[model samples]
Structure formats: structure tokens, C-alpha cells
Target: MHIAFVSLETVHHRDTETNRRLRTICELLRDAGHDVHVFCAPHWGGDHPQFEQDGITYHAIAESTDARSGVAFRLPIALARAKPDVIHVTATPPGQVAPAAVGAMLARTPLVLEWYGDGGVFPHRWRRWAAGRADRLHVPSELVATWIREQGLSGDSIETVPNPIDLERIRSVDPGEEVDVVYARRLDEGANLESLFLGLAELRRKDWTATVIGDGPEREAYEQLASDLRIRDRITFRGECSREERIAVYRGAHVFAQTAEHCVFPTEMCWALASGCVGIVEYHVDSSAHELVEGLDRGFRTTSEAELADAIVEAGDLERLDYDETFAEYDRSEILDRYLVQYRTLQDEQGLL
Candidate 1:
């Protein structure tokens, strides 16, 4: 099977969850003996129009000087050249949906659009038209699939495929006991790190240490807040760690704290839980973390900062958490097999099987 992935940004340019997932999917498909190709805009040092790496082909549709223009102008040519059996495009806000849709039509291939964010009906005419053009819509969660259906997408058009995680890699080592709590997320306004700082300040009355893993625009402000609360000494901000470093931090922490006001099935929290850390999520109206942690003994959903502090304290008392049963469905191999089934089904429907 020949599968071509169309996206605006390359994983080499941005270290985002969607880009990472795209790369993972390509790798999985390639490993399954499928010919997988990624069509994306060029990134830094990626001057070639086409290159092969890690058993997959990468075709640059446009240079970084003007990626949007490149997508509109060059994507169809690239798609025609690749002549993929099925076209899989990933859509985020500001994605190249229109261009990808056009390319798929030009190639006369079955199109699959993967929505990478919280599902909501797109109100814009172009976006709606682009989404409607797809032969199938793949979403990451049931919540998103339901929301898309509420927006009038037919049940047959939408499929809920949860994000994939490398469970073996996440569970490779035993958790350390050096850090009492760990918070991992971009320190942006939506992350609500201020609440975590306040809650940690409250936890200072007890003996606890925390390490913040990640970096963003709010780093300085969060550090200052930690200082103002006089809990700076007990916290360390290790910004934007490598994958190995992040896994180490998760292993070293006894508890993982999520204070984000908005989230869509966070991968880091899953990694933390799978890495043997107890999970605590501060509840918010827009957050989907509760969906993952609710009803699990090792996980707690807190409605208030006070509750978060208390949950952290309670988590510190737990000796171990068995996340295998809860996270079994998220295994990378299982998710890859699901995607393969979807691809083969599309191929069979199109008489390409």
C-alpha cells in the first residue's frame, strides 16, 4: 500500500504533538511494509524537494519563506508525482486543508482527514467544505467524534482513534523517588501554571519537591510567581527536555500534576501515568483530562486548588499504581493496527485492495 500524508508543518520544524504523531504513524506504516510518504513544507536545513529518511520518503511542497503559498502552488504537483493509493491529511487550525483537499481531488485518491484538536464543527465555509470533501474523518477521542457528529457529520464518516503511545518505552524503567511532584506542559496562559504554583505553595507546609518540565512564553512569569510564593527553592524549572530527559523526570516523580484549563487528551500525562507516577488533574470546564483519570484509583480530579494540594498529599502516600489495564488500549502497536485497518478498508472500498 502506498500512503501519502499531507501536512503544512514538518516534524523537524516544530516539536508538537501532532507533528510527532504524524512521524510515528509514518514509521508504523513503513514498518508494516507499506510505502509511506510525507508531503510537507520545507524546514530549516531541509532544502531538498524530496528526501528519504528512516524508510519513508519526505517531499517538501514549498520552502519556509512562504509555506502557505507553497502548499497552494506545489502540493498538487507533489501529490501527482507520489501517486499515493490513499491520501491522509492532518488538520489543525491554520492547516492547509484546502490545498490538501485540492491535491487529493487532483490525484483522484480517497482522502482521509485527521482532525488533531478538540472536535468542534468548523464554522468557516472553506473549512467546512474541505472537511466535507474527505472520504473519512479521523478524530483522536470519542469526545471529539461526538462533537463532530453533533456538528452534523454522519456517524459513518467519523471514526474515533485514540492517540498512540509507546507503552514499552514509557514503562522501560522503575520510577525514582527524588521528586515528589512533576508538572509537564508548555508554561502558557492556558496551562494555568499559576494555580499549580499556588497549590504547591500550599503544599510547602509539608515536605515536597517538584520539577517543572517544559518551556513557553510564561516561563519567566511562572518562575517569578514561584519566588513570590517562597516555594522557588523547592521547585526546579527544567525547560523543554529531550524525550529521554522527560522520561527520566516522569520516572523520578511520585506524582504528576496537570493544571491546564484546557487540554485535549494530553500525551505527557499518559506517559507519566504509564511511567508509574500517580496522576492529579485540576478540573476545568474545558479540560478533557478528567475523562482519562476519573474512576481510576491512582488518578484524582480536583475541582479546586485546595483539592489539588490535598490530592498531591494523598498521592504521595500511594506505593504503586497499576496503569496497564487502563492504558492498554493506548498501546502504539494496537493503534497502528487500527489505522492499518482503516487504510485497508478505504482501499477495498475504492477497489484498490
Candidate 2:
């Protein structure tokens, strides 16, 4: 089947969860023998002529193109020409959904919306309307589906799929090297980084060295807080390392500690667990991250700093398990099959079969 992805944002232009998922989906579909085409606007710091990468082909709409606006002008024409069975779009840019809905309407094809199950920030009004425009919708979690259904979308119209784990070349390295805790996430708004920071301070007071491996809007604030907490000397801030570096750090460390205040992060942390690090989650009542690691791996969910710190230390000696067996369900090939099921479902509903 011909499947075209309409994304207003460029991939390399931004380092974000959305970009990573979209790129992974497109490439996986391409590998599965589907004809995948992409339409994107200019990247944040990049303004280059249109080009394709890997197996996916891309077209830059225009110099001043907005992803939302790109749909009205470029998308319908492309969809009419390429004639895909379905057009899957990310639930962002707030503007892309409307135009793409209309394009699919004109082509009489299905439009499916994709997003992380974070109680999507998109308006219920828009999501409901977007659902009406498309034959179906896709979300990464049941938690998100509940939120969208509350906004008037029918639960039957939505399918839940797990987010893709961006796999890197992981080598099986010895896991008993050091007793360290590693935190890797953007220190930005909405990211509850302080939980990890203060937790780090609590550990370092006991003479442990915590590694912080990312930077963002709250970088300086976190840095200052580390100094104020008197744990600055015990932390190593390796600002923005490449994917390889992150995997290497995971292999060398004994534990991977992730506690993002009020955000769901188990999907990313699962990669760390799969790579053989004992995972540690700072427990919170509403944290869906806890649910991801409960039964399959070596992650600990704790309610207090003492319990958390103790868990970190305990992770070092625990026998490392092969999470590859657990997470293999989310591998590129598996995700593609789930997607193909969605496409076939849409086709069946529209009587295209």
C-alpha cells in the first residue's frame, strides 16, 4: 500500500520525541515495502532545498511554509498524485490536521492522527473534529485515549500503539564497572528535572557520583540548584552527547535513574533497561512510567529519596536481565505490522478491500 507521511516539521531540525517517533515510523514503513513519501517545512536552523534521506523521500513545501499550511497547497496535490491508502499525520502544528483532513476528504482516503499518549495538548475540539475528518486515529497509550475520548472522539475510532524505541548499535559490554546513577533528558519546561537533581544530591552526600547527560531551558537553573544543594562537586554534566555516547554511558553505569516530574518516560527508559542497566524510577502516584517497568525488568519504583537512593545502589549487584526479549515487541518490524493492521482496518472500514 502507498502511505504518505505529512509532517510540517523537519527531523534533524529539532531533537524531540515527536521527530524521533515520526522518523522511526516512516523508515519502518519504507522498509516494509510500502511506498512512503514525506512532506515537511523548513527545519529550525536549516533552510535547504528539498531532499530525501535513507529510504524515505521528502519535499520541502516552501521557504516560508508552515506545516499546518503546507497541507492546503502541497499535501492534497501530492496525495491525489501518489494516491496512498492512508495519510498518517502527527497530532501537532495544530494547523496541519485541518488541511490534511480536507485533502483526504477530497481524495476519499483515510487520515490517521498519531501522538504520544500524554493527555495530548491538542484541543478536544480539534481532536474530535480531526477524528471526524479521518477514518481513524492512533495514540501511543490508553491514558491518552481516555483523554481524547473525553473530548468527544469515539474510542472505537482510536487504536493504541506503543511508541518506537530508537535502537542504536548496542554491544554487550560488561555491566559491573561502576556504581553510578545516570539521568538523560532535556532540562526544559514541563520536565520535572529537579526530582532527579535533588535525588542526585541526596546520593552524592553519601559519596556517590551522579551523571547528568542533557541540557535545555532549565540547565542553568539546575546547575545553580546543584551548587545550592552542595552536590555540584558530585555531578558530571555531559551536555548533549551523541546517541553512541549515551549507549556507552548506559553500558558503563550500574543504574539508570529517571524521575521526570509529572511526565511519562518509561518508553525511553525501557531502552536503557533493554541495554542491561538496572532501571530506577522515582515513584509518583500518577506516573505511568511505573507501569512500563513493573513486571518485565530491573527498574525500581520508590516513593522516597532514601528508598530511591537505596534502589540505585541495589541495581549494581542485581543480575542484569535481557530486556531485548521484552522490548523486541517494539522492534521496527513489529511496529510496522501494527501499522499495517491499522491501514488494513481503515481500508476495510472504508470498503476499499
Candidate 3:
């Protein structure tokens, strides 16, 4: 299958969660023997498509929305060039869907959409209508699937494809005697990271260390909060890293604690599990956490900091949540197989399988 994945904001845009997932999924599809191409508006503040990286092909094109009208301006040409068997879209912004809708129509390709987050954030009808028209919809967690249906759509349109991990990248890390808690996500508006710092402040008194492995807008605020909490020495804000660095951090950490309550898929937590850490999740709701806990059953969900703190305390005793079981589903071969299946299914639906 020739698959074209379209997204204006890609992981390269900022190395955020959704982009990371998009990269992993596209890689998996390519590894499975399907021809896959990625399309994004290069975040380098330029226009036109960027070509293949390593073996993966990318087309970074002209894009402007309320901020950039170039989104529609870029797609039709890219679609004509790609001539994909299936066009998959990620994160459908209200005004942006028309570009996707137009591009897919012009290319005469059926569309598959992987909605990255809940519509509650968007709160608009244009997105809803566009979502309904897609050939198939993917949600990374059941919680997200539920929310999609709650918005008056058919559950038949969606399938759950959890965020994938680079099993090989994680397998290289040798777990030693390191005892640190790891939190790896962007520190942006949606991430309520300040609370995690305060919660860790309470834990530092117990001879535990915390590892933060990402950068975001609140870097200054979070660093200041750490200093104010007097846990600065104990907290290491290892800024954006190559995939290798992240696996190293996860291997050395004993627990993975994420307090963000709004993610459709708290990808770092899944990576930590793949890295063999005991997962401690503080999701706003249990949807994503339940999916995280499916393997080793290591995830703990709480709505309050006190509860999150209590979870941390419990996590201290969890000697080993053998990640192999949690990560088994994401084994390189298995992930590739799943995509092969999705590709074939889509092709069969188009009489091209």
C-alpha cells in the first residue's frame, strides 16, 4: 500500500507527543513493507516539502492557517505527487480539515484519520463534521475512543492503536542500581507539570531522585519552581534528547511518574514501561491509564496530588514490573505485523489489498 500521512504539526515541529507517535507509526508501516510518505509544514519557518530522512520520505510544504492559509495551498500538489493508496491525517484542526478534505478528493484516495486528542479542546463543529467523513478513525486509547463516540459519532468509525515504543532503542539500556523517578513529556500549557515538582519535593526527603527528560515553554517556570522547592540538585532537566538518550534515562530510573491529566496517550509512560520502570500515572481520567496498565498492570491513576504522592510511595516498593510483558505487543516484528494488517485491510476495502 502507498500510504501518505498528512500533518501540519509534526514531531519535528516541536518533538511533542503526537509527532513522536506519528513518526513511530509511519516508521512501522514502512518497515512492514508498505510504501509510506510523511507530509508536514516544516517547522523550520520555511515552505515546500522536505524529502526523505534516512529511508523515510517527508514532504514539508507551504502552510498558513489563521496564522499560516498556506495549508490548503500546499496539499493538492503534494497529494498529486504522492498518489497514495490511502491518505491518513493526524490532528485535524477545524479550518485545516478542508485542506485535507480537498487534497484527498483531488488525489481520489480514501482517508483514514488518527485523531490525536479529544474534541473538547477543539469545541467546534467543523472538526466534528470532517471527522465523520473519514473512511476510518484511530484513537490511541479507549478513553479517547469513548470521548469520540460521546460527541455523537459512531464507534464503528474508530479503532484503538496505542502509541508504540522503539523496543530496540529501549532494549539496549542496562538497568543498574539507579533509583530515579522519570517524567518525560513537553512542559506546555496542557501539561500541569508544576504540581509534579511540588509532589516530588515531598519525595526528595526519602532519598529518591527525579529525572525530567524534555523541554518546553515552562522551562524557566519549572526550573524556578524546582529551585523554590529546594529540589533543584535532585532534579535533572535533561533537555530534548535523541531517542538513545531517552532509553538511557528510562533504564536508570526506577519509576515513571506522569501527572498530566489531558493526554489521549501519555506516550512517555508507555516508553518507560518498555524501559522496564514501574509506571505511575496521574491522568485526569482513567482511559489512557487503563491502557497503559494492560500489560504489567503497573499503572496507577489518581485525580489529586496527594493520591499521586501516595502512588509514588507505593511505587517505591514495586521491585520489578517486568516490562517485557508490557512491551511484548510492541516488539518490532509484532508492531510491523499490525501495520501490515491495517494496510492490507485498507487495501482490501479499496480492492487493492
**Number of the top-ranking candidate, with lDDT as the measure:** 1
lDDT of 3 by residue, 1-353 (tens): 78888877666765655677778888877776777787766554345446666567777654532415576677767786678888888754455565676777788777777776744534656567668787788778888888788878888868787767767767676554475688887787766777778777777768877878788898888889899999988888888987777777777777888777677776777777787788776656633765676545566766677777778888877776424555778566776676557766867876754
Task: Determine which window of 10 residues in candidate 3 has minimal summed lDDT.
Answer: 60-69
1-353: candidate 1 lDDT, tens digit per residue: 89999876767877676777788788888887999888876653646677888888877776652445657778877787778898998775344677778888788788898876643457556567788888899876666676677777677888877667777876665555479889999888887988878888887888888999989999999998999999999999999887767877787778888889877677788888877778898887666777778788898988888998889888877985523446777888898889888888887887776
Identify the runs in model 2 with alpha carbons over 4 angstroms from their true place.
12-15, 42-50, 60-63, 67-70, 117-120, 124-127, 166-168, 172-177, 203-207, 227-230, 262-267, 283-287, 313-317, 321-324
* Candidate 1 wrong stretches, greater than 4 Å: 44-48, 63-81, 92-95, 102-108, 118-123, 321-325
Quote each prediction's TM-score. Answer: 0.86, 0.82, 0.80
lDDT against the true structure, per candidate, is: 0.79, 0.70, 0.72
Q: All predictions: root-mean-square deviation over Cα?
A: 3.0, 3.6, 3.9
lDDT ranking, best first: 1, 3, 2
- Rank by TM-score, descending? 1, 2, 3
